[model samples]
Target: MVSRRQLIGAGAALVGAAAWSRTSAMGLPEAPTMDSAATQVPPVPSQGPHYNPVVTLNGWSLPFRMNNGVKEFHLVAEPVEREMGEGMTAYLWGYNGQSPGPTIECVEGDRVRIFVSNKLPEHTTVHWHGMILPCGMDGVTGLTQPPIPSGKTFVYEFDAKKSGTFMYHPHGDEMVQMAMGMMGFFVIHPKDPNFMPVDRDFVFLLSAYDIDPGTYVPRVMEMTDFNLWAINSRVFPDVAPLVVRKDDRVRIRVGNLTMTNHPIHMHGYDFEVTCTDGGWVRPEARWPEVTIDIPVGAMRAYEFDAVYEGDWALHCHKSHHTMNAMGHEIPTFIGMDKTKVAKKIRQVQPDYMPMGTKGMADMAEMSMPLPDNTIPMMTGWGQFGSLEMGGMFTVVKVREGIEKGSYEDPGEYRHPPGTVAYEWTGALPEAPSAPAGSADGSSLRPAGKSASAAQADHSGHE
Candidate 1:
């Protein structure tokens, strides 16, 4: 595979000006926003929360300062210790001390001034992944402006004109910085609560890393093979589940920064692709969907009414994305008789044990030793058995009596009797006879000569 650096260096000359015009917001539709505020100290237009804030696990929304009617937020780009899962951490570069950084929340028409202080070992620049802004504020390092040098601070002032789900990340190093987990979600809530009102709103960025076991830092140069897939810099079972009340309208805004696309699949109910980083889709333009594919550097918002009362799964459709610490070069052992060889090898080496003789599903249940501070290739245990899942996997639990805006863990769902899968407990019934023409005494052979004569003729033949 061509390295990202080589692609950037070569593609830069051919797609530079054309790429900016096509990608960096030329004819974006204006985002929709609310027009009124009802419950507040004085009913401020863009003040006080308009809707119930979505909980970002291991992250929070950036608090802004009211500086003479202009909202101000400070983003410090520095090194951070990000927890990918239980017993696993990576040394990554992030904004505001979080791998995914803090969620930047604003309203349409709000004048925002963000101060970004760079403390990294090298220069960097923040790119608004899907925002309509001035060319100078677009944050392309060489095209729009010079890179922000280390130890220096840069300020980006712009009006929050569009209301939708968006993201921010380094546009300077492009490959290295992004691969190191430097990204965050930027949400501009609609000004009109009635426009896109939902009982609950959630946001997270889909990111991937290539951090090997026993290593503290990620390999930022890796572009294709990623061992650690995460949602908001966390893997399961460390990732939190989406909890909602029955009949509640929920919005899940997902942004993808990984090298590949992710078809995010949700079970039990169909949702609508109501919005994107570009803008909100019109009601008539929206369609029901169970899975939405989010491409690299793009964001998608899925909204649906939570009607099912169970623990439904939500994960990346790519099977490999649902695993961790996988070895791409592991030899396949299918159909191989390794039992005898394994026993002989075990006599010499006590730890020798052949695996994958049947399939890899057994790895989920095997109590094998792993490196310290590392997760297994696939690890998630449930009431049934091992979940056999790892990265980019989470559950959406809807119950009957959850408090409004409360995200308390509802625990595992208890299935009703006869609903759970189990072994057969009743007496076995007799199977039916074989069909006609079958070899199980259902058909007869042609008879020509006596059996003894045919046996004697064959016995004398060579």
Candidate 2:
């Protein structure tokens, strides 16, 4: 097998005038850019000490060159068109090609030099999140070093002092750059490969965007009110499934770049959080968790054995995070008949559709026409039926016979007889009713008002 450095060197032909003129002039290595949104299998080191490479969901690892006993990498900051999902494309400023730029992996104690070319409209600097290095290499644009001006290239040399989960993003014009999707994972592997070895490892970042349903660029000024919650910039249905061979020990590392926290939940098995952005946890200090809360600007890594054979759900526990392009102004219409109003609206608009009186499940599955360049607020078709999901949701498929090193989808799981949930249809029995007076609160009124007055006040408030 060819070394990743060799394969990346072949991409020198892809270097444009902006990269070639500056990088070659400075004897810098070529920066390889990715063009796809699919999850890529981790690359193997051709002649180096063995280590388990990580799978980047909807992303890839950055390739590095061995130059004079040092690892050399180049990154280009520029605008890119990213496919957030099947039919949605977002224009974002990122490194190399994709938003939440390619994962950068290195081994502990390795000396590394990274050349960064700025092709964006503004100056930017690469902050090594969670990394310990010289004060000058901290990447704070004004404090540690001057910003890398637009159309210029700068280099940062550092040594990987520790092995753990880390990240990189712009420190100059930080808010706008980050809101426009410019961040990536930086992983430092242990020098001893056998230390905490696992069969498969995966990494992704939690990000949220405020792009309108039909827009191509995000609202850089958005502080809260982010509508699209994503894992590695790709929403559900477009996010690739995590495929695992049954009984294989697996590790998943997640970092939160969003403004808020994410409680990432897994269905099949309980796992222990073995690492964080700081460093590895002591074996005696680790704890089991089914859902791990990844705080803003932090990382959490968990491990579990793939003992269950099924299609299990993995998603952010916050309900809104699993939906897409939602509107905050839509009034709840459950149990309210909007037919007469809808009829009146149809006479003038002819395309008015009433909100579902039952629930959004029925509404989301309807064939309502949506805007161009966007998908429904909540959508996905599973083998069973409508998945009714969108952002920050994906399945973890555990199966019996998957080949090692294969990340390909194994299709839907075939349930054994009597293993699937079925609807009840046999007998109807009388059920217990609500306790007396609990329905209207007549028996629990406060001294300030009578039950009738309280009811009237509640009605008025509604």
Model 2: lDDT of residue 250: 96
Task: Show the colliding residue pairs in model 2.
Answer: none
Q: Which tens-of-lDDT digit does each residue in 1-462 have in candidate 2?
A: 233334446554222233344645458786777788988675575433456788999998876666666777889999999999988999999988889898988888889899999999999999999999999999998999999999999999999999999999989988999999999999999999888889989999999999887789999999889889999999998999999999999999999988999999999799999999999999999999999999999999999999999999999999999998888788888899888999999999898878768888975578788787777788888778999998999999999989999999999999999998898998988876656479655644456897788778778879
Clashing pairs in 1: 33-191, 33-192, 34-190, 34-191, 34-192
TM-score of 2: 0.89
Q: Number of the top candidate by TM-score? A: 2
* Candidate 1 residue spans exceeding 4 A from truth: 1-51, 426-462
**Candidate 1 lDDT, tens digit per residue, 61-98?**
65554555666667888887787887887888887557
